[model samples]
Target chain A: MKIKKRLGLILANTILIIASLSVLLPILWVIRTSIANRLIAYKIPPVWIFTPTLDNFRMIFETYPFQDYFLNSLIISTAASLVALLIGSLAAYSIARFRTGDPALRLSMLSTQMLPPIALVIPIFLIMNVIKLWDSMTGLVLAYLSFNLPYTVWILISFFQGIPVEMEEAAMIDGCSRFQSLIRIVFPVALPGLLSAGVYNFILNWNEFLFALILTGRNTRTLPVAISSLWTQQGVNIGAVSAATVITILPVILLTFVIQKFLVRNLTFGSVK
Target chain B: MAKSSFFSNLPKHDQQTARNLVVPAMLGIWVVVLFPLLYALYVSVHDWILSQGGIGSFNFSNYFTVLKDPLLLNSAKNTVVLTISVVVLEILIGFGLALLLNNKGIRLRNIYLFILLIPMLMPPITVGLIWRLLLHPELGIINYVLSVIGLPQPLWLATPNLAMLTIIIVDVWHETAFIILVLLAGLTSMPEEIYEAAIIDGASSRQKFQFITLPLMAPTILVATIIRMIAALKTYDLVYILTRGGPGISTETISYYIYKVFFVALDVGKSSAMAFLLLLVIILMTFLLMKVMQKTEQNY
Candidate 1:
């Protein structure tokens, strides 16, 4: 019995360690490839001992308008998050307090998240051309709201529903108007949900690819779109690609750490909670 | 001027006002989502290509033209193959990881979860790019390790069979943590008394798992599988960046096929037709999942 138990423990740990290593392997290679000297990166056996260089990272700035793409991603994601929050919070508040829409309407709202970007791309391509919003951050943010707004409403509804109403009633007794009470009371109380929702929306928008792929032009192209373009011109440059990949994902990874606790909650729509 | 007085009398009207609040967002979604959806339907039935001026005629020809092609059939099969394989692998790996971590008693479990989740949070494109580097036939670390073990290096993304397997492996690596979290949530929330009762009855571990854990975790499993299905069906970025439906279109799933027809071939009408086909599959899956989820919620 003791021998079997020991064997099980050893096996589980070995499996776990191996799994962890596999998860890290690709990521570590990307990091290594980013800093590896150009010659060493291409070596068949992959040289382990070598001088690391920042040339690829530097080349990103010199060779491409990486900064523009970077800035476009940053601005668009932030703007989308803010806009989604602005309208979504009100709608969410309404739904939480007043049970806003009928079942069909609410389900349709949720259904939009499941709508594939492909469904929108063809018409949106034509729509953007007619409106001349194609290749602009405004157009990208508008497209992003299709998903982000619904999500924001759903998440904030859960947060708002969880808050007790007595506090707002108490504010009403103190002569604050209904709108004032909402602003003064519920807003502060739901700040955590709002923050998490905003951050979540920012992450979604930041990672959006298909919309930006067709919607944006060369000047307004986001990072993912720009990254895809790397393959188009000529032979693949593994080092520059790796560095750009790391750079592109670095902020998103950092932001996700803050929202880790809220992920399952948001993902399951508070059902888990 | 008097917001409090305005709402003082009609509590019933508050609900009306609240419903009205949804109007702005509803309108916003309609413009972005529903309007374009209607447009897609219109486009799907017409002969349209952006490069060829526009909308040549109104007909069901686009649907037949797109659907009759062998590419759609090939991609549909690939989509099913990829989705089932990846989701199954993820569920198994996630369950194993969850059990392992649950048994570890919580101290180091979070660290493992954190690291395991890193792959999931990164941009799918970067996930593809980094893995592409790691799977490079010659210089990649994967081949390096295989050589060390005296194994033959298979042409991965460049080979038809291996390419499908390659994307599945990357997807499993990226998404298994999702199942892990869902199952972990279920595991942690399980009443300790149920397990204690089983233990007192001398229920073996596997017996307890089969009789209690599996039954209890079924709803969570369904939800996880459905969500993963939608994600897998809509998959574009990783396959786009990593495989490009390559090595004789072995990796071309529905989304990738639509993207090729829409962007590369510039066939708008056929692209929308294929898009709706994908959407119908997703909507049907989601509707079934939602029904089950609602039932589970009601029972709980």
Candidate 2:
């Protein structure tokens, strides 16, 4: 029995190690190739050891205007998510505490959250073109709200529902107005939830490709668009593409770890929670 | 539960306050989502090709034209195949990993999880780009390794069927993390007392899982499946980045096909009609999946 249990344990760890390597090796290969010079990057047998260079990163920024794209991504993601959290939190609080919209409105929010970006992006693209908001930050941010707003409200409704209402009611009973109680009591207590929703929305906006691809032009292109354009450019630059891929994904990986605890809850729209 | 308390149950003054609070979000959703969808509905009926001219006369035939288009039909088939394949593979692999990690005797579980979950948050564009380089015919390390081992080095994205399989493989690599995370959460949250009771009764591991874990996990599995299915049904980025629906349109998903219509063909009206059709398919699939899952849950 003891030997059999030990074999099972070894087998589980072996399987886990293989799975982890499957994920890690690709990323490590990317990172390895990212710093390799053009010659070594494309070597058939592969150069397992080499002095890494920052030239690829430097090349992407200089040749590709990645710095501008990075800044655009940051500004758009931040603005869209902050707006979503502000508006979404109020509505979520109302719905959670008072069941404000009850089934109909809440159901719409859930359904809208499930609406494919393709369904929304095509019309938004046409409208943005018509309104001359195409290639503009404001237009992209608004387009992002189509998903981010519904998602934020849905995730946060559950968060707000979890917060006890007694504290807000106590403050109301003392002298605070409902608005004051909301700001002072509920918001403060729901700070972690608010932060989680904000970060989650921010990540979604940052990584959003389809909307950003169609709506934004040269001036407003985000990182994903910029990186995709690298592949389409004439002679595929392997090192530069790897470097660019690393740059685009690095912050997201970091931000993901920051909000790791809340990810399952947020991604499932708090249904798991 | 406090959730049962309706807005009508609140005082009149409080009810007014709640309504006021919800207005901004309602307004935001209206302008951003509802209006565009309504406009999309309006546009789908018109003949609008931007490069040619402005919106033309009301033409409901856009839907019929798209339905008749071989490319649209081809893409619909591809989308269904891709969605089912990816969702099933991700769930199985992810569930297997989750169960392994859930074992109490397993060591280095957290480290394994951290590595596995990294791909969950990666931009689909970057994920596609990374795999594109790795799967490149001549210079990619994968081909090199396969050759060194004296195995057949297949053309990953060059051939028709190979391109579709490559996309599916890449998606599983990128998205299985979500399933692992969700199902792992579900597994860890299961009551220890019930498992202890089963163990005391000399229940084997297989029997414990069959009777207890699988039945209890049915709801969570359903939720994860539905969410992944919806996203997979609308897949576009990987197709765009990896193959651009090519090797002669073999891997063209519906979303990618619609995108080509809108941007490449400059046919706005047709694309909008196609988009609505895709949405209809998604909603119907989601509804049907839910019904099936509920039935399975009851049976379990």
Candidate 3:
């Protein structure tokens, strides 16, 4: 019986180690391919051993305006998210504090997120064309805001609800106006929720593909759209594609690490409560 | 008496005034989201390709043509298959990983969880590119590894049947982390006393899981499943990047089909009609899921 139990333990450990390796392999492959030279042109048993080089990185910069794409993505994602945070938090606070809207209105507001973005792209495209905002950063930002705002409101509504009413009430009693109390007292208390929402929205906008694809031309193309261009063009360069993927994912990976704790916390929100 | 009455009405006035302030933001949301959706529906029913001078005529022909198209049906069927397979795989793998990590004795639990989540954090295009490289039949790591193990390597993206499977596999890998993150939190937060009682009642491990954990995890599972299903149904970036709905249209999902009709084919009227149909399907599914979730929440 002792030997049998020991065997079972070893089996479980072996399975766990294999599972970990499976999860890690694809990421490791990306890092490896980004540095590989001459491996791209070869089809001979897929050599894993190769001297690493920055040739792909050098070619990527020379071939495209990667810096411009990076700046475009950064500016647009940040601007859209900040604007969404401002508008969504204010709306969420009012709805939570006053509870004045028809309940159906609030519910319908949340349901907007269920509307797949593709469904609205044509109408938006036409509208942007009519307004002369087509193929512009401003248009792309507006389009992103339309989707991100609804999600932000829903998420922030729940966050705002979790705060104690007494904190705001106490502030109100101590010569603070309603707006003042919200700004000075309630906002500080809800800072973490806002930050998490902001980060999530930023990531969403950064990673958005379809809107960026349809709405922008070369000058305003975002990183995802730019990376996608690698495939459509002739003479497919696998190494450069991998390099762009690595570069594009850097900001998001760093941000995810920063917000990892909060992400776990918020994802399980109503489950625990 | 008059003064007292005025003071008594102050709460009502404050509430009314607050509503007035919130009205602008609420209206802004409606104009930005709902108005465009309504307009899309309106335009979809008409022959309204922008290149053709816009709104040439109000007709049901566009909808009729799209509904009758064999391509639309094929795309819809492919989408359903993709969504169901990916969601099912994600749930199973996600639940397994969550349960494994939730075990108290698991070493490096936080590190494992963090590493597993990297796929979810990476942008969709990057995920696509990585998988595309890895699945390259001749020079890809996947076939490379398979051959090393003395296994016959399959052409993942080149074969039609295998192409859809490849997209599904990459999607499952990308999204299972999201499911695991949500479910692990649900498991950790579950009350332990119920599990302790199950042990005392002489339940075997499988029996305990079936009778206790499954039932308790149902609500979180429902939420995760619905979110995953919606995401899967609307999957475009990865499919677009990886296959471009290729291998002779075998991997074309509904969203990809709509893009082809609108952009590539420039058949805007047909694309709009297809978009409306896709919207209807999504709305119906979302409505059904919401009802189930609400019912489950009420029971809890």
Candidate 4:
């Protein structure tokens, strides 16, 4: 019995170690490929000993307006998320404090998230064209707001409801207006939830491809669109592609680290908590 | 001055007041979300072509055409398969991992959770690009390692069936963390006294899990499954980067097919019709899920 138990323990640990490696290896390969000189002809046995270079980084910037795409992504994602945060917080506060909408309205708003972007793309495309906002960052930002707003409202409403009403009541008794009480009392308490929602919204907008693909043309292309365009031209520059991928993902990965705890806390919020 | 004061003190509710309070946000959603949905529905039922001036006529021809298209039918099949495979695999693996992490004696539980979450945190495109390189038949680390072990190296993204399988593998890797996180939270939050009682009564581990843990964790598992299903249904970026719906359209999910028809093929009417169908399917599924969840809750 002792030997059998020991064998089982060894097996579990070995399986875990293998799983960890599988998860880590792909990321490591991307980093390696970004530095390698000739990934295309870089042998079947795998060239681990190749000298690294900055040529990929150089080529990506020189060939395409990679920096411009990066800036576009930054502006659109940040601005859209900020708008979503502002609107969603106000709406969520109203719902939480006043119970303004019926349960059906609340559910419907949440269900807007279930409405696939593909369904709306054609109409959105036509609408953008009519407004002469097609192929522009402004248009893309507005498009994203529709989806992100509902998500924010749903997540934030649940979060705001979790805070005790007595805290806000106390603020009101201290001569704070309802608005002041919300800003001063509820907002600070809900900061982690707000941050989590904001980060997720930003990531969603930043990584958005379909709307970005349809709505934006040459000048306003975001990173994902730009990466897709890389294939359109020629040469299949693996190094430059990897470098671009790394650059595009850096901010999102950093934000994920910052909000990891909040994400875990809130993932099971509505059902379990 | 008294007259002015009386005017100001008049009842606050008015048409102007009501519109002022609701108009801004209401207009924002109406113009962006509601208008587009209405317009798409209208367009889907018509023979619309933006290039040919505007909407041509109100007809069900586009819907009939799309429904009868073999390509669309194939795409739908591929999508359902992808969604089912990924959700099932993620649940099994995620539940196992969650159970393992929930054990009282496990060390570095937080570290394990965080590491597993890295895949989900990264953008889908980045995940796709990473896997694309890692699955390269010749120079990829995966095939290289396989060959080192004296095993045959499979062309993952190059071949059609293997491409679908590879995409599923990548998705499961990325999504399993979400299920694990949610289930672990559910497990940790479950009432402990009941479990203690079962243990005191000489219940075996398997029996305890089957009777107590499974029932207690059901709601959270349902929640996780619903979210995963919705996400998997709309998957696009990873497949686009990995295969571009290539190798004879084997990995062509509905979203990818919509992109091709709308943007690539520029068949506006057909794409709109297809998109509308997808919307109908999603709504019906969501309604069914909510109903089932409500019933389960009542039962509990």
TM-score of each: 0.94, 0.96, 0.93, 0.91
Kindly list the per-residue Cα lDDT of model 4 for residues A33-55, writing each as its tens digit: 77777654256676667778877
Best by DockQ: 2
Q: List the residue pairs that clash in candidate 1.
A: A135-A217
Model 2 lDDT at residue A18 = 94
The digit string of per-residue lDDT tens for model 2 on B1-300 reads: 455566667799989988998999999999999999999999999999989999999979998998799989899999999999999999999999999999989879899999999999899999999998898889888998999999999999989998999999999999999999999999999999999999999999999999999999988898889889999998999999999999999999999998999889999899999999888977786565545544654211
Rank by TM-score, highest first: 2, 1, 3, 4
Candidate 1 segments exceeding 4 Å error: A1-3, B1-13, B105-107, B298-300
Q: Could you tell me which 10 consecutive residues in candidate 2 chain A have the lowest summed lDDT?
A: A101-110
In every candidate, how many clashes are there?
1, 0, 0, 0
Ranked by TM-score, the better of candidates 2 and 4 is 2
Number of the candidate with higher DockQ, 1 or 4: 1
Q: Quantify all predictions' global Cα lDDT against the true fold.
A: 0.83, 0.90, 0.80, 0.78
Answer with 1 or 4, whichever has the higher lDDT.
1
> What docking grade does candidate 1 earn?
medium
Candidate order by DockQ, highest to lowest? Answer: 2, 1, 3, 4
Tens-place lDDT per residue, model 1, A1-273, is: 889877887777777778887888778888888898788778877787888899999988889878988999999999989988988898888877766554565566667788888787778888988999998888888899889988888778878877898998999899987788889999899998899899988988888888898899877899988887785663678888888888898998898888877887766655565
Q: What C-alpha lDDT, on a 0 to 100 scale, does residue B140 get in candidate 2? A: 87
In the order shown, the candidates' DockQ scores are 0.56, 0.64, 0.51, 0.43
Model 4: TM-score, first chain? 0.93
